[model samples]
Target: MSLRLNCDLGESFGSWKMGLDEAVMPHIDQANIACGFHAGDPLVMQKTLTLAKQNNVTVGAHPGYPDLVGFGRRSIKASAAEIKAMLQYQIAAMDGMAASQGLTLEYVKPHGAMYNDMMANAEVRSAIMQGIAEYHRPLVLMLQSTPQAEEHLAEAEQAGISLWFEIFADRCYDDDGKLLARTKPGAVHSKEKMLAQVKQLQEQGTVTTVSGHTLNLRADTLCVHGDNMDGVNAIQEIRELIS
Candidate 1:
């Protein structure tokens, strides 16, 4: 059972810093780096990719709404066309940044509200997938590992997009396998419990939700937020435990 660990990184904007990326980079297998619109600047993007290269961590574009003030966590209404354009633009910038350093983006993960919206709405998910298929062919799309993905897999496959199923190391899930909203109780798993969940996944290829429902979920990767410094410490612990 080779479960890869991923982290959302490079979220700093301008002079304001948002994460402990430097401290977290060396511990993970893949990095979902932020593009400028959400919570990064050109310099920050470049530096983040450079660090990824240095650490030999795989890189992916993390695009979100153009809400810098909200760290791309705030939802904004946009047409399907508009959603496609935003994803394409951000992914292109990340790819270019990677290329400049003789690297390449390996996947795409929509951030914040964009991610949540896509998870809940097949229309939005299909639109976003169609958009990525046009601009970033060949890069895997990292999305939640839910039954919804199976329902929409055909459309994405038709568009020539590959999907990467992801489970969170620091979050809780509903019976449906959709993540519980962050505002809800038991949404964020504690380090001990998070690692236990990881262990369960490694050993059983599934996890028990907060509702005590067993979900048969598989993953190409597991995620830990770079800003989750406390979670960062557990990365080493997870590796040691799993090893």
Candidate 2:
């Protein structure tokens, strides 16, 4: 499989700048942009779209819970209908922003707590899928690839949407193929180990889990975070390796 690298970006809110997006955008294939609900403002979203266009990077909506203070990292209690409405609103807003820049959002990847909740909660996952299905534009849904990938594919198929499974290059996974919580010990891999994981994925189409079990995961994309200069450098190295 051809592996495309994706990053969560456009996280700057007002005067608070976040991420080296200009430096990292050129090296990545896909940009999952935040859409105001989490970290982006109107200007930031427009700027990010412009940068993506200049670099010829594919853009996707990265919607999250409507929590600015927590950066959408904290989960909120909401019903399935509320979640669906929230997702559709964010997506429409993003599509509008992209259209203004002569660009189109190709996919949707929920951000932060929403992403984690989607993976762990079937009801939330279904709600998200249903929301995407009801959208005006046909867009792919990018989600984590786990042992339950087949099930996820079935759900997406039922929702009448396409799915792009993604794997994390620098995060450790549990036996069930879910990413280990960041609070856990050794949850994040070192740069050397991250490179090794990328190499293994290129060669074997698998990842070694935290419990030392080899898990087979089919991935169309690889997710990486480039928040700083060091991260930008790592992304450059990853680009070279994957390219």
Candidate 3:
């Protein structure tokens, strides 16, 4: 079983640096880059793409609601049409950015709160897939690999898009197969625990939830956040295990 690693990159805004993208790039298989919505700007995106290219990492667009102030971690009420437009606009911008530099975006991953919303709301998921289909691009959508993923398959197929089931390498899961809130106790795992998680996912194909429930999961890629020094260290550890 090969587990591909993906990390969110190029999240720096104007003067603020969000992650050690350069350090983290070499250890991962995929890069889900911010498309100037939640975070990142034109220059930052270019720099990140250049780094990913140098490292031979597969690139994907990380689109989110336009919430620079909230980092796209806040929920925004919008219709399916609006959500579709938002995704198309962001994905196109990033895809064009990648193309200009002789790189191609092969996938899409919604960032932050939008991701959480999509997991729970069928309408939202459909809207996002609809948007990707409307873009008329052949791109894999990276989404949580919960059982409900089946619910979104029709839309994905209807939209003529593919999907890559994603699992988080460090975050704790709930009994419902959703990620635990960051504020919750035991939501984030320690280094040892994270490694144990990888082992379990490899051997048992299930993750133990924070509520002491075991969740059967399907993972095509594991999300490794590249937001800080700890995250870089985690990525290195995860990369060694997966490779």
Scored against the true structure, residue 182 in model 3 reaches a CA lDDT of 88
Q: Which candidate has the top score in TM-score?
A: 2
Candidate 2: tens digits of C-alpha lDDT, residues 37-129: 989998999999999999999999999999999999999988989999999999999899899889989999999999999999999999999
TM-score of each: 0.95, 0.98, 0.95
Q: Model 1 lDDT vs. the true structure?
A: 0.86
> Which residue pairs collide, candidate 1?
none
lDDT order of candidates, top first: 2, 3, 1
Q: How many residue pairs clash in each candidate?
A: 0, 0, 0
lDDT of 1 by residue, 1-243 (tens): 788888888888888988899988888889999998889899999999999999999999999999988888898988999999999999999998899999978889999899999887878888888888888357888898886657667767887898888988878888888888788999989887898999998899888898898888868788876566676688888767666
lDDT of each: 0.86, 0.94, 0.89
lDDT of 2: 0.94
Best by lDDT: 2
Higher-ranked by lDDT: 2 or 3: 2
Model 3 Cα displacement at 146 (Å)? Answer: 1.2
